[model samples]
Target: MAVARLGTVVLDCPDPLALAAFYAEIIGGKAEETEEGWVELTGHEGTPLAFQKSPGYVPPRWPAEDGSQQFHLDLTVEDLDAAETRVLALGAKAVDAGDPVRTWRVYTDIAGHPFCLCAC
Candidate 1:
């Protein structure tokens, strides 16, 4: 038997509403600011994603410069080329860090958190 089940993954960001909005845009859901500086996204197919305000939130450096990335989201896309174009329009910045394979690409949200668009 399982002791406990997994819950929503919460991300710390300078602007909870903005970060949550970003994810909601890609994930197809509504981002709700339920409380002061706290936001939650739902109505998607899988686990929920939430955002919490960090007063002194310093965005992570992808190559781990000033601070290392603690975690990242891996999102599957049907068409990498199409998704890339759309995400970029939605304020996602592609990371130039060397990716040997063409199966996936790296990008950062407006808040500078790393995520991947995987074709697998």
Candidate 2:
């Protein structure tokens, strides 16, 4: 048997360009086109961020309050306040995630996939 390592996390989006822009700005990179509905950002250091178009894309409803949170991204951070502030400014929604918020806050991306910022 051979060992393996972590790769990229791909989240479907409505518009690759637009979603790429949101991620590029938030992560500090540039999106390079591959096709009509596909683009990639190549400055992520370890792995490239990729986006694909889904015309029928419907943002995740998040929480039973609206719909439901199907999945989420957990990001490790050094400072909770700083990370939350930055993501919040960048349009991430802050919902009640009490226990998790003690060390991290769960926020939704522009597409509504929940992501967590925690002490790294």
Candidate 3:
């Protein structure tokens, strides 16, 4: 039997409350408490962001020799420049780019997760 198909993407964060606010701003919405320090953002409806609390959670030092991350997130936007601006405004730090800042640009979230902003 096929299990019920439900839910979308959910990001893991050490601080749900803080991460919730961060994503809420970038995703353009508010985050609701799902369980104590754990916050959920279903404001996007189809897409749900689940935050798990880990008191000792330490953000990875991405693009550095500190820690190695197993994965990352990528978002597509109509305009790369505009999207970069928006994400930066939401507290995303620009990681690095090749020569030109076109096509795609990598950025690290408040939690130090590397994500890409690509032109669609």
Per-candidate TM equals 0.89, 0.77, 0.77
Best-matching candidate per lDDT: 1
Q: Whole-model lDDT for model 1 versus the true structure?
A: 0.86
The residue-by-residue lDDT of candidate 1 on 22-75, one tens digit each, is 888887899898999889997887888999999998878886876667899999
User: What residue pairs clash in candidate 2, if any at all?
Assistant: none
Off by over 4 Å in 2: 2-7, 64-68, 97-101
User: Poorest 10 consecutive residues of model 3 by lDDT?
Assistant: 41-50
Q: lDDT for every model? A: 0.86, 0.74, 0.74
> Where does model 1 exceed 4 Å of error?
65-68, 97-101
On the 0 to 100 scale, the lDDT of residue 82 in model 1 is 86
